[model samples]
Every structure is written in structure tokens, then in C-alpha cells.
Target: MRAPTTPLRPQPDSLWRAIAAPMSTGAPLARDIDVEVAIIGAGYSGLSAAYALQKRGVECTVLDANPIGWGASGRNGGVVSSKFRLSFPTIASTHGIDVAKRMHRLAHDGVRTVEAFVDEFKLERARFEHTGSLRCAHTERALASICAEADWVRTTLNDTSMSVQSRAEVEHETGSKGFVGGVLSADAGTILPLEYVRGIAAGLNARGVPIYEATPVIDMSREQDGRVLLTAPGGTVRAKQVIVATNAYSNLTEATASYHRELVPFRSAMIATAPLSPELDAQLMVNRRSYTETRRMMKWFRNVDGRMLFGGRDAFGKEGEPTGFDALQRAMVALFPQLKDVPVEFRWSGYVGMTFNALPHVGRSDDATTFCLGYNGAGVAMASLIGQHAAALALGEKPELALLAQDGLRPVPFHALRAPGVRLVAAWYQFLDAVGA
Candidate 1:
């Protein structure tokens, strides 16, 4: 196998960025304006909320620090799985069986919403695929737990679309012998994440929503007339309500500094190999299903246009290093030996917002200021749902995801030490993963 000759530079270039067409660089917020709603962050969440609000005849403006799809929405693995970071059993134990079931339904609904968006909007450029997902087990005990979880999903949740696969079956499906067993969810799938977000932006643009790229809201405050004032580099937006959909890239302004304490931004890196040969592609990941392991620091991979895209907890520190790319390449080789010498063409990383509790949070930071974020790396599907719910909340409507609203946003303990604490916790998790705990 040919190894990396030099250290990989930590560049912001991503495979998605190369493949997806550039979105139109809409003008920045050039002048002060008043709208019914102003959205911060032009990612999937912001665009989805804008679409929803447009459909409801609500005027909204979207502001972003960078171009659309420049955040996690464009840099994710694009698995689009309905599962959250925490397991169903853990959710049931913490909340209740009914709440867990509700959450599951909500996640499934979120997946369907993405499907609907792709279909209704004709997002063929997004490479939307209905291929299912495989949750593989790295250990025998984990396989048993996966089996139990599958059973619970079937009986408790009445979800007949999910099934467990034995080691032999999983091996046949994935062409990899590393996993002991797996669970398949037919509802899950994959898409070109950057294309998907850009497609949404296009729809919003068509609907006359002003999306101000490279315009960050430097400050936000309330007016005496119960309106919100958002100050940007070029101008300001005065709106009746505001939604913060910045997710992991949230900047700490006077109005949003408290939100920084509620979530931790953890960097996740990804690597993609050059397009594989037809023979190699047919031998590895022939099913074209998104796959991830059951490890605490898990690995996620999928086949995109005959190329292998793999990602995981490659870097535990704040910044990504060349060692992280080496780790991911090693992981890919371990799973599919036939690609041991495959040339890697892309390496990138992005941050994911993780909350104190493992669940995504959506609520009003204060009256006229609503926020929805903290996906724990499962933002593709849930972000769309949460974003729409956030828009609805801003419009004085009750959001459908009640659990997120009920849980509310609680700042992590010792918010100032989150960076060091996250590193220590990552180290502990890595130790546990290495020890097979």
C-alpha cells in the first residue's frame, strides 16, 4: 500500500466544495432594512426556515459569515440517518418510553421531510439516493446490543423498516469482515450535502428571500417596540423576530454569548479517495449504503459516485492534523483491504455542536429571539425539522418537536473550561474504544 508521502495540510477545501457548483454570491446586507424575521446563519437550518416562512407569507432575511454551505451542512458525511447521538434505550431510560417513541417518530419525520424537499424541489443535482444505512457493530457485545435495539425499534416503535443482519449477512452486504453484525434502516439514505444546501438556497432565492453572504451579525439587541435589531458589517436589520441557526459556527456576540455556553464545538474530519476503479468499487461498498460503527468514537463511511468518503473522530484536539488523515486512511484500509493503495484526493474538517444533554435543543433564548441547534453531528435531517420548528416558534406557533422545547437549553457546567474538558473526555473515549469497553 502506498502511504502518504507528506503531512496533509489543514486546508478548508472539501470534496463537496469541489463537486458542487458554486452558489451565486448574493450581495451582502448593504443597507438597513426591516423584515418580519431575520435569520442568522445561512446553512440548512436557516434556509429551511426561510423556505417555511416564505410559504407562510412571512418576510425573512438570512445572514451568514461565509458563503452558504460553508459550515457543517456542507462538510458532513451526508449519511442522512434518522438516529441521534444517543441510543433509543438511553433516551427511553432518561425520558419515558412514550417520549422516546415520539422522538423516534420525529426523527423519522425529519428524514421524510428531507426526502420531500428533494422530490418536490427536483434536487437531482444533489445526487439524492434512497439507499439505506447500516449501523455495524465493532464488537460481539455491541452486536448483541444492536440486535436488542433492532427488536426494540420493531416492537416498541412499530418500525418494520429496520432489520438486524448477522455477521455473514453484513459481510456480504458491505464486503468487509470487520463488523460482527449490523442493523439496516431502509428509511435512511445519502445525498450530496453541499448540493442539497445550495439547492435549498436556490429555492429561497427564487422566493425573494434576501440571503446576505459574508455578512455576520456582529451585535443583536431588542428595541422598545418589541423588535430585534441585528447589526452587521454593512448595515443592520430590524425585524419583529430573529432565529439563530448558526449551529457549530456560532459566534459569541453580546446576544449570543450565552448560547456558546450551551453547546461545545467539536471538530470532525473527513477524507475521500479518488474515484475507485470499477472492479474495486464493485468489490467494496457495492451496496452503496451509508455505514457507521457502534463505537463511542464511531466511524462513518459511504460510497459517492464510485469514490469512498470516510470520516470519524480522527482528531480529538481543537485543530485537525495530518495524523488524523492517516488514521482515517488506516481505518478505510482495515475495512476494505482492496483499497489499501487507493489515492486519497480530499481531506477536510468541520465543527459539530454538541449539547450537554445529547439531544438537539430548540427554544426561545428570549421573547422575539428563537434558536435551534446542537445536533450532535446528526444535523442533516434533524436540522431541517428543527429549523422549520424554529421559524414556527418565531411566528408564534408551537413547534412540533415538544421534547426539544421541554428539555430547553441548559449551559454546560464549567463552560469556560469546555475546550480542555472536551479534549480530556475525547481522550477517555479513545481509551475506552481502544480497550474495547
Candidate 2:
């Protein structure tokens, strides 16, 4: 790993950035250019799309307002769990059993996609750990849900890689006794998020796919010649097709205003404690399994390189600064009293794009514009898969998982009031969680 250098715009002072390996922040587009496909955003989705396009021998370039890994891709918790925000049984009941099974397969394929990238690109510093993840229940209702999920995974999905645990088993697995019960999925894992994304950017550059940093697409319009014209601050991009992969930052440009309306952006925060002693580390996170809560207002933690990383919601402070360090520390201490004195060394937050369906979307705005976004806090795997599907859609090819492909997305209702609405929903969820609802 290498020390992070400064970028054009100030980015979150995240622990991932601090320890990420170095990669070039390619120069901004400074002149008119034409390409087969143009991508906006330098995060996982954009870079992955560029890679797919490049592999297919298609001409493409990536544009971002900031440097590579400047968004949620670099800042998010690197849990590579093969599951969505909604459970499989719920999807099975809502959608048909076939569609639910396909969705489940897609989720597993997403994990493989990321693993393949790491292995194919030799991203050793990304530290891809296949230690698996644990989903702990905060309430008995949550425990019941976990049990249902486990049963569904085994019976319906015909997979026995997961096991349900009792409260004593949960306490044994995680050093904390806060959880009632839990389920462990052996397919889940962890990585250094910034390192992984930066490694992807490196691989893309090696493939000759130009990634222009600090180049924002201000406006987009269609040309009479049936091509798409993108107006960037430094130059213009004329492309046969365009891919908008900006996700939560879609609101930054007028070109993606409609895409922004399809998602409710929420700030997610995380804190990291200084490295723990070998004894304490072993005692806290036995087997080094990634841990998460089943509460609506979710919480997650894991030991990364001897440091304890705890995360939850509402981390943004005034003036773009990160808040809730104290609250996060208190929560962490509450979970594991042994960490009461473990000083927090880092605090940061990033925005996640939430869809009304609580699932990702891959679709086209027009015949010439393709987009894939709204990972609902599971972007590490889902974003990569969606990006690949977005590329296939742009190429006029059917995506393997056809359920995700759509003509367009419906806008979130009352989009302007989402901020306050999110606060209210979060408060209600917290209240219900307190009462074990």
C-alpha cells in the first residue's frame, strides 16, 4: 500500500484513502474527442463499464469530477456479501420463484465478478479476504427473519453454505453479546475498498481506456446526426452512446438530473479505531468474520488489518465535515465493552443511492444513453455487475440477468423532500427497532 496524494477537489479523509495504493489521476479531457461510448463517473460502475467496453474492443473514455475512488466506491465498507437489501424469500413472494432464483444467481455472480477482477488484475494489496460475514439479529423478530433467510437459502436456493446460530453461538462468534442470534454466509468476504477500486482504475489504464479525472459533464444533448454530445468543463465528448454511472453524485450535473431523481441519496458513516493488540483482536472478532446487524437502521463492523471498523448512518456534519464520531464510538463500546478505551483514529462518510425498490437498476434513458446505479449500500459487488450489464445493454446485447434491464426508471416520489423524509423514516425505524418490531 502507498500513501494517498491530494486530488483536485478535497475528498473525504477516509481510512481507505489513507492506506490505498497509488494510482494516477489521469489528466482532464482538454479537447474535443469522439468515442464509441462515453462514461461519466470514476467509481466502480463507471470503471467496470470502461473495462467491459475495452475488452469488447470498443472505444470508450471515463470522466469524473474528482479523482479515481473519490466517491462511495473508495469510501464504502468493503463487505462483498452476495445478498441484496431485500431478502430472497420476500423477492420470491413478490416476484415469481424463477425471477427470485435468477436474482439470487445474479447476486452470487456479482461476488464472482469482483473476485475475478481481483485475481485477474493481481490486486494483492486490496487484501481480498474470504473469511465470510455474519448477520446478527438485534431483536427476536430480526432473528426470525434471519432464520427464514437461512431456511430459504438451504431449501429453496438449494445452498447449504449458511448456518443459523443461537444467542450463545452468536456471542461465541462475535465477542459481543448485543446480538440475539445470527446467520453466517460462507460466500461473503471483505476487501480494502479504495485499493480495489484504484486497482481497477489501474487495470483500465493498462487496457488503454482513458479515465479523465476532474472533468465533470455539465450538460448533455442529442445531435441531429443521432450521436450524443456531452459538454464537459474542459472539452466536449461526442459518442455513439453514453453511460451515466454517477449514482449518489448524479445530482452534480444537469445531464443526470433525471437519474438523480430516481434515487434518494443518504449519507453513511464509519469510524476506525487504532490497531488493536493481537490478543484483543482475536478475542473481539473470532475468525475475523465481517459482522452486521439485522436492524432497519443497520450497523456493521469488522477487523481490518488489526483495526476495528464500525459503521452506521447519518455521519455527515456541517460544512461537509463528518459527524457522529462520538455516537459511533459509543455504539462500538456498547457492542464490545473491551473497546471502551480504544481511541477512534478515523471518521468519514459517503453517500449511497437508494432506490424505491431497494434493488439496483440497469436501464437506458434513450436509445443512446445507458445507466446502472442505486446499489442501496451494496455497491462493491452489485455495482460491478450492474456496470457490466450496462455495458452489454449499451452494446445492444441482452444482459444475462434480463430482469434488471429496463427501458427507464421511475422517479422517486416527492424527491425534493427526501432529506427530511429520510430523517423521519430513520427515526421511526430506530423506534421500531427499540421495540423489537
Candidate 3:
């Protein structure tokens, strides 16, 4: 008798990141074939691994429950950064300064990689932007924290993007008058999420790496020879090494047991108004710089095509439905105080797999032949690079990047309780916002 395969937690929906129209999806994996590596989940991580593995002349098959970029990669706000998902000090305390530095560099380089990809491939879907970003403080008390953070980066990390943003700079730049000040970093920007995915997929396919959609790895069992049996609805694939890059929509595993606890797959919402007047943008943003707040329950915004895209996590309770456009418009008005009359053209929501520490978990594991998962919230670039790390580590080409080695992914203690924990945290913030505390 065969027991039922475990249910993989559902991935987030592509609300705002939805295509203006239906896009093209590729073929499926028909028959099982032996390969040097098998990667699950076709977001940035999966696609990146395909590119890297192909470059090294390795046979790799990318499997996705849906299509590439169909997950959070295509649905997320396009801002990319390696800014500690948790605070940097915490990472230094845990992974030490050297590893922490490497993490920061990995994230910062995602910007360059995307830009380079755009230039080399000439992909029209990705809108490569270097509009810089403003990490602003919503409260006076919070100002000191940013200042300390900036000082630490400069004196210790030798980083220098922590310049002060006087109230005038904030007012003049964002055009959303008000606020004490903030820091402007030139190390980030926005892009059309889907374009980024399609471009990467197309490039990988051109290089002969096969990517299959509608193929979910249903169940897996380890063979005596340490090979893995990945059973999908159609058939089973046997592979020597596997890399699991499936975040929110991934199969939870005995191998990924604790990671489920460490990561929180919660829904966040974003709505873009019909392109506002071009003047509205010159007034709203200096150079399309990404803007996020210092509050615990923060809102982030970016400018695109004369439209303002605002994202926030406090949309509603469970089930993750997009609040009607009217509600979102009202929230935007409250934030800008000037957009009360503006109209929104698109609204969408999706789930992001957030690690408790908010940083990414990389490395190979002993539980699986070779596997790595959990990106917390920062996946744009880090996740992309992980494919390179995972495949490389799996092929014995880069032993340092193995998940079973130093700096491997750690599972959270009780992921089954994550929704409850997230609810408790969300409840407190919801209360704080209610009282203006």
C-alpha cells in the first residue's frame, strides 16, 4: 500500500505582477531522464542554476509546479537588495564578519547581474533600473537607529550609502512632503518581474537546459546508492543530485523539516494606479528610487511608467484576497496625503517565504543527495546566485558552498505553527496602527 504524498504548501498568487495579458508557457517533462542535477521550482533560483549548470556543461532539468516566474519571483516588488533580511549585527554575531561580508556582496551584485543580463540578452521584459533607494524613518525615534546603522557600515563595513536625507531632501525627492530624514543608497532599483524571469528562462533554454512546467515533484525517496526518486504525477525522475529552490510553493520535506518553521509564507499586497501625470512622478520621486519605511509594519513604494507602485503586508487576515481597489486607493491617499483623488489601475497580492531571521539559507544537505532552500524574503539576486552555489557544490566543483558544510540552511523549530505566530505579530502591529502608536 502507498501512502498519500504530502501536500506542498501553496505558492503565492500573482496579483499585481499579473501579466497585462496571458503570456507564453513552455513544454512539460514527458519521460524520466537521468541527469547530473535536478532542480525543483523555477523562479530565479531554478533558472539561475540552469544557466550556471549549463555553463559548466552539466545536465540539469528544472521542474516547476507551474511555469517559470509563476511563483513569487514574477509576483514580488522588483526591488532587490542583500540588506540583511535580519539586521547585519545579528549576522555578524552568528556567521562572523567574513561570512557576513560575503552575504552583503552576494546581494549587492544581484543588481549588476540583472543589468548585465539585460544588456547581454537584450531582454525587453526587464526594466533594469539603478534609481537608488531611500530607507526612510517614519518616526523620530527610529531616526537614531538608521544613523547608527549607517555609522556602523561606514566605520566598520566601509560602506558609504548612509548619507543623511534632511526633511527637504525627502520632500524634494519623493514629492511626498513630510518626514524627518532618511538614507539614500545607489545600490538598488526596480524591474518588470516577469520580463526578468522570461529572459532568464529563454537564455537558459537557448543554452540547451530543459525547463518543464506543470510538473511537480510529488514525492521523493532515497535509493540505496544515495540517488533520489522524484515522483511527479506523470512519472518518476532519478537523479544523482537535486537542488530544491522552491520557496513558498515548495514541497515541505523531512529534509526541509525545520526550514518550514523558520520561514513565514505570508501574503503582501500591491496596487498601481493608472499611470499618473508625468509631473506627478517628478513631484513624487526624484529618480524612481525605491522608498521603504523604518516602521515594523512598513510600506514601500517605487515609481514606474508614471505610476506609483505601493506594497504593504497588512492587507487582511488569512486566505489572502486583494482588498478592492477602492480600499487600496484610500490607503495610498493616507500615506501620501496628496493622492487621495488618484486612481489605481492594477492591484495584486502574493505570498513571500520569509525566514525568521529574514536572511537567506543556502548550502547542500546530507538529508538529500544535494539540496538547498529557504530564501526568507530576499530572493531576487541571492536566490538566483544560490542555483550557482547549489549546482556547483553538488557537482563537487565548489565544496565550500555545500549545504551540509559551514553556513548551511537551518530549519525553524515549528513551522506548522508559523501562521499562528505570524498572526500574533500581525495582530500587535495592527493594534499599533489602530492607535497611532
lDDT of 3 by residue, 1-437 (tens): 23323233333434334542355667556666777788887888888777778888888888876767777788777876646556655666787887757656666666666776778678766777777778877666677777777777677787786577877888787776546788877787777787787788888888788887777776767878888878776656788888877777663334334334446777677788777776676688766778887767677888777788888776655435545335556656876876776777767776677765565566655545455455655567666666677777777765333221335456666667777878799889867755546
Go through the candidates in order and give each one's C-alpha lDDT. Answer: 0.83, 0.86, 0.69
Cα deviation of 150 in candidate 2 (Å)?
0.8
Global fold similarity of model 1 (TM-score): 0.94
Q: Clashing pairs in model 1?
A: none
Query: What are the root-mean-square deviations of the candidates from the true structure over C-alphas?
Result: 5.9, 3.4, 4.0
The segments of candidate 2 whose C-alpha lies over 4 angstroms from its true place after superposition are 1-7, 316-319
Error of 1 at 56 (Å): 0.7
The 10 consecutive residues of candidate 2 with the worst lDDT sum are: 1-10
Pairs in clash, predicted candidate 2: none
- Model 2: how far residue 192 lies from native, Å: 0.5
* lDDT, residue 378, model 2: 93
lDDT head-to-head 1 vs 3, winner:
1
lDDT of each residue in 155-234, candidate 1, tens digit only: 88888888989999888878889999899988888988988998988877877888987777778988899899998777
Question: Candidate 1's error at 183, in angstroms?
Answer: 0.6
